[model samples]
Target: MSGASVLYDAPGPKTKARNRLYSIVGAVAVVALIAFVIERLGAKGQFKPEMWNIFNYADVRNNLRDGVLTTLEVFAVAAVLSLALGVLLAVARLSDHKPVRWLATGFVELFRAIPLLITIYVLWVILLANRDALGLSGNGPQFWALVVGLTAYNGSVQAEVLRAGIVAVPRGQAEAAYALGMRKTQVMTTVLIPQAVRAMLPTIISQLVVTLKDTSLGYIITFEELLYTARQMSTNIIVNGSDTYVPVIIVTGVIYVAMCLALSGLATWIERRGRRTKTGVAPATAAPAGDPATAADTGKDPAATP
Candidate 1:
């Protein structure tokens, strides 16, 4: 029987047949649903070669290339800043001093509680209003606003992830470090943080994916990111007597999926590497290979008996 059947009584032949029938029905339903969607899209000319031909235009290609570059730029900056801020916040929240802990907790709670869209919009407006004073120009307000908003929200979340990883460390490890006369800072920086990073690397990379997607929010502030470029192409570039909205959306979405999958693949590779490194060889046995009774009777170290 399958392991799932262990939770309850194994299905009898009749029940197994019924389950197979249900599975077949479900599969047919899914196939029919997909067929219907494809039929509708085909009728709407979404599958027409002309709709996809806009991608062949030089201007469209340039715009998309620039959009992808800008999106990656924002993601790179936000990712680095968020990670740094997260580390600082996590350390502060874990501080022994009550004031520092409370301050860090409040900051994380505040940012994490607010809607990310609202935060980005507010920052955009505020920065735009003071653009001249801040020496801001051409996309500066939009760029900084999006970057800072993402940093605040994601940093707060990353702080919690890191803190959880740190807390999950074996208590004995911390005690052992303390016994070695390491100060709290030394213990955390040298011991807890490194192990926590290894344990939490996957979660960290997942959050970075979230950060990448959230860069789309920059569209609202006119940041000229990927989605914004897609919108422009769909609206302005007419082909085959119709706007290329569907094709543009499909292409941009595939790009986003490709980037996210790349990140996930990197995370998986790193996790495997970490596991291999952590798997140490078994210690060489000092005990001799002999009958335990004989070794004990002769008062010889069982490990040393040949």
Candidate 2:
């Protein structure tokens, strides 16, 4: 009883034992259910292997590679534009001018409130109508419409993320910048924005992932993106007179997941590099003004002396 009391206070022992038992039971049940489902599905031919065989075809491979490239192109363009728009909108919303602030506020709210699918569809229709003036040809209209719609929606989300990041920073920092006679735009661009960017990098990266996934929505506008290529391939390649939809879908999904995972890996590397430095930029402290002694003296004590 004394040994048990020292290791796991009173009721803790029973609770711990119960939790372990429950975990083991849960794991076993999940494995059993999964095994049963897989066996049943396999027996019924629902898990056919040939559906995934389309990847071996040169045509399918070429089309999917093209689709992958197009998807990356659209995502890159939209992500950059969205980040730029978000920064501008965030600054505008924080503006002293009533009109500028109001306009920015309305724009962010309106787009954020609307579903991205509807926004893309509407833009597609609008672009199709004025295609000649916009120099639209080939996949240009669909691309631009997808880009613009994604920009608006993701921009709104990123504006809020930026605003939140800015607000999270110590108020003293902004006040200090202002006290130094920096103009509003200078303070925001040179100081606040950079710091906010570092602090909110994860959120920013997550929004980029959203933008990447949103590129699939381009299919609705007839854009020949990844999903469109998959659908086309499935339609053209019927295995034994049956649609090869499942195989193409699996391949396309794997492509998207791979791209996203790569982006995530890059973000992780950046984050690690940032942690090795200060503010994801230059070292916070510059080289000493002169001698090491003078530099140390000039720098305020990190801990308050009693």
lDDT for 143 in candidate 1 is 96
List, residue by residue over 1-306, the lDDT tens digit for candidate 2.
557569654557778899799999999999999999878856756467676666788988899989999999999999999999999998888889999999999999999999999999999999999999988998888999999999999999999999888888777677878988999888888889998999889779988988999999998888999999889878988775688876677678888898888877777877887766543222234243544432453354433221
Q: Per-residue lDDT for 100-202 in model 1, tens only?
A: 9999999999999999999999999999999999999999999999999999999999999999999998887788789889999999999899989989998
Candidate 2 Cα misplacement greater than 4 A, ranges? 1-24, 44-49, 279-306
- Weakest 10 consecutive residues of candidate 1 by summed lDDT: 278-287
Against the hidden true structure, what lDDT does model 1 obtain?
Answer: 0.89
lDDT of each: 0.89, 0.84
Among these predictions, the greatest lDDT belongs to 1
Clashing pairs for model 1 are: 287-303, 287-304, 288-303, 288-304, 288-305
> What's the count of clashing pairs in each model shown?
5, 0
* Candidate number achieving the greatest TM-score relative to the actual structure: 1
